[model samples]
Target: MANVIEEAKSGRASCRTCKKTIAKGELRLGVEQMTQFSDTPSMQWHHLLCAAGKLPGELKGALAGYEGDVPNRADIDKAMTDSIKSGKAKPGAFPYIDKAPTGRAKCMQCDETIEKDSWRVAVERELEVNGFMRKSPGYMHPKCVAPNLENVGGTMEDLVSQVKTNSLIDEADMDAVVEEMTGEGGGDGGE
Candidate 1:
């Protein structure tokens, strides 16, 4: 089933975005997900505004098909527009490229701190946290991406394709990332 925008049937379902209860009869966005336990996909509910912020593209498509009234259509539309332009990916949607927002993240390949304001490649990695294994975003320098992907089961070509499809960065930034990842255009050849 596709994603949908509809009213909450009950207050029991807490929004996946904010972890708050969606008051009964309030508008919510449901993103369809497939679980291993069930053949039928289930819907993950989020508060309408929260979905607009975090899942802009998905929410925009769902909103297009929704026939009911929306409480703050103007605000939600503006937020979705701004979010799409921000070049940030939805939470847990990896294999993208974005500028490092902070200097604290270290490259998974070279283990060096990624400087803030520089472009970085983000990929999904499995991590064990408090005895539970889950997928999380891992950061790497663009120059380190080829080698990292070699060890992690993807080629530079595959990575470049995924980054191009998944990233929201503008054309110029995307070109630079591709050049660096592919060791072309004086990118030190993944040194």
Candidate 2:
């Protein structure tokens, strides 16, 4: 399928990522795909920045194809660059951590509260399937990392290193994460 990025011809398009209108004459990204229910082609529209973030590879070529000046072209390019550094530019596996940013989540392993601002290990978890299913990203307590890592075939050291390299983490902060997992930081290690 062909991917194209150009200014909106009409003000009716909504960004697939942000669900906001793309004003006429503003740059928009149009991802072409066959309609889900039909062989006819369709376009998914997103604002320039939204597309750059969600479709980094497509953006590189689409930008090359557009004839007019792209606003914040550098910013979008940087977002794509950062996404590459952060392991989000492509889709595979690169687990990491973040402060719960919110406390609405529970640990998939132990089913306990993941308190706000507490560090969470993001892991791709698979379901009980007879065949194959796409794994879902879920949160786990640092204490619960061991069993889950065994289940998912990854190592804590690898995960920690990945988080450090792909994210803005402090040396001391990651050290604390280690200490927590090893039971040196307190709380029965992540019990």
- TM-scores for every candidate against the unseen true structure: 0.57, 0.46
- In candidate 1, position 131 carries an lDDT of 98
Task: Candidate 1: list runs displaced more than 4 Å.
Answer: 1-41, 44-54, 57-82, 86-92, 128-133, 186-191
Residues 26-144, candidate 1, lDDT per residue (tens digit)?
99999899999999999899988898789876676677578888989999978876888876645324577888899999999999999999999888888899999987779999989
Residue-level lDDT tens digits of model 2 in 92-177: 23365667878889997799989999987776767757777766778888888877677756666666655554333445677677
The runs of at least 3 residues in candidate 2 whose Cα sits more than 4 Å from the true structure, single-residue gaps closed, are 91-191
C-alpha local distance difference test of each model: 0.80, 0.71
Best by lDDT: 1
Show how many residue pairs clash in every candidate, following the order shown: 0, 1
